[model samples]
Target: MVKAETVDKAYEIAKERYAEVGVDTEAAMKRLETVPLSLHCWQGDDIHGFLNPEQELTGGIAVTGDYPGVARTPDELTSDLHEALSLIPGKHRVALHMIYAVAKDGKKKDFNDIKPEDFDYWIDWAKKEGIGLDNNGTFFSHPNVKDNMTVASPDKNIRDYWIQHGKLTREVSNYIGEQLGQTCYNNFWVPDGFKDNPIDKLTPRERMLASLDEIEAKDYPEANEQDSFEGKLFGAPGIESFTVGSHEFYQYYAITRQKLWTIDAGHFHPTEDVSDKFASYFPFTKKDLFMHVSRPVRWDSDHTVIVDDALLRITRSLVRDNLLDRTHIGLDFFDATINRVAAWVVGARATQKSLLQAMLAPIDQLKQSEYNADFTTRLIETEELKSMPFGAVWDKFCQDHNVPVGFDWMDNIHQYEKDVQFKRN
Candidate 1:
């Protein structure tokens, strides 16, 4: 382990270098501490929530590997989450799907039948951890997702069942925010589309909009519940031809309804990116925007995030546009192949590292150069900024927060696997 004084010495040297370029390392670290990345709970258990363990995971989602020690109950998931959070710097929130709701008597309950009390334990757990909560209505992997249709189902009964579930989920989200004293970002996404070319794509989309309207009709207090919509380009094998909730559809819907629009990293095509949409949607967002930061390999594989160019660009855009506070960032990838806690720490740290790097950049200088019409200097400085001592600043940030710096976290993960996870089998 690197000593505190050594980390401080590295920070002081890096701090002087950054100061010369008009960036304050200390202020950047302080800013990063306030940004809470919502950690998705599905990663700990590979999205196999404690809802109905007997049901098979379907509806375009699958956990690739059969890695052992997957959390089987709410308590086990909570324990794993606690271990992961300890390794990640700064306070963070947890993102929960409706399926994670725990019944008081440990009985299985259907979506529509679920209540806020089902999530009482989560709220209590969040309180103890001193973190906030975000929520999502699970719209896939259920019987009601008949023929891969959820909110956009042509059948009235199937549509109504999902709508009731959505309404109930919103209520639970509101309750969570009310209990935690922070606005919970309640997101809605559906896997409604056809495998082959559809004769009428318009009808399904229209149905989905109506179903969502009905779900949102049950107005909850804005202070507690802030709702948003997510759109995907495609889904599992059969649903590639048409995903009912495409990006354009939800972008228009969110604009019209004046709600936050969620941009999931894995929801877009590999060539396309949401980094450019920051300025476009920043004006339309009412209160705050939301993002599901997942690493997409070719498609929505939900790979653990690394400090790649795409992620750096996203964070840079947010920092350059001054939208960090206006955006609610959350991690949303699940890789069952590796140690789940290590996956969380890796992705969460990568996210924090990217944010810190962006913050430490001399964006003001770059902007000033651009405004002066010195395009050559702007290009040169931007390229040169890449090699700056951002790692030193990141090390200091982790040191200040008392979390492991760099690969030092791997030691803790190895110990955890032997002491906790290996015994799960």
Candidate 2:
């Protein structure tokens, strides 16, 4: 089949899927007019030529209608973006996800390695490519970089390493805070806990200490106030040990005692290796971690999964635990098959909705209860108490506002229920 016809056919099929479920793919696509990079969390190491930020469909609504003429090179991609930008309706914009795995020039460290004027030129290039950092001008740091060191290297004791790293990282954060102003700093999530036996590897407590140092760093007094430090659920090359229960709580107390952590939703599944068949073990107190949203396919945990009721209930539990004070819920996602724009909206709407879901609890009464906070906490986590009713109420609430049952509906979520309103800050 000719490539142009093939693209068109895909667009049509996506549209039909949305129609089958009653989504207005056309209007939703309109919401995708301007592409925002922050909405996407996919990063590092791959370089796929940019395509339509509108190359996404959500709630079953297909945004891009198949452009047989779409170009695949960097130059063509930028031109396509310019043309697409013109068609967007109002102040609204489409969302663009960061496809880091497709990094052709190698995971972004070398923008202009050859030219000495790299930094200035790279910023311009970033703007053109619509590239954005989670927070501005932020990068990871370890305690002994001058010595060519790292935070969780195979050589050090877990706790002490964090202590040194935490102090140093905080200093760097101050620098970022002073430079970026209102922008939050971006944090990578490689500090959960460790799995493979590395006797001296850094501990989460130490990691938290370093993170807190960054938050309260003296150089940037407003470090904590300006942007959050995003902590990861897994350490990756190996999972971090400070996951759930008391250890995580230790870090949560220490960090919030200093700043904020954006909890990613899907980190709970660490590459989604769970099986309904076996007893699964989770390491962190789902409540203690302020989360971002992501879902994994089959069992892949780190992949940011789409937000839904099941994920909401977990956040609701945090409110009961009084843990929300230390967390920020961002929509972290990557959908290879869907348009990046649609995925952004879906994740955004879901986080906003989940925040409100916590508000729905009888906050008035909970305040009066003895373990008021404890009661609220139980309201969300005590499995026996929160089941069918919580979900039923939530589903109905979403319906009132115009959220889809799944990714089956397409269009701007025009149906938000009456008392709910979300504003982007």
Q: Whose TM-score is greatest here?
A: 1
lDDT of 1 by residue, 1-425 (tens): 77788888888999999899889989999999989999999999988787787678888888888787888888889999999999999999999999998989888887777889889999999999999999999988788889999889989999999989989889999999999999889998888888999999788988999998999887788889999888999987669999999998988888888888899988998998679977888677565679889999998988999899999989999999899988999998889889999899999999999998888877878888899999999999888889998888999889888898877889998898889888899
Count of steric clashes across candidates, in order: 1, 63
Instruction: Give one digit per residue, the lDDT tens place, for model 2 in 1-425.
Output: 12334434554665555444334444433322222223433311011323223223211111223312333443443333333232222222122222211234433422111121222222343455443323321122323222222333334563344434344443433433333332334343333344454465446356445544543454445433233434444432334343321224434543455433344444444343212101111133232233455664433233434455556665556545554444444445444343333444555555544544454444434555545557655455334333313333333333434444333344322222111112110
TM per candidate comes to 0.98, 0.45
Local accuracy by lDDT, each model: 0.89, 0.37
Give the per-residue Cα lDDT of candidate 1 at 376. 100
Global CA lDDT of candidate 2, please?
A: 0.37
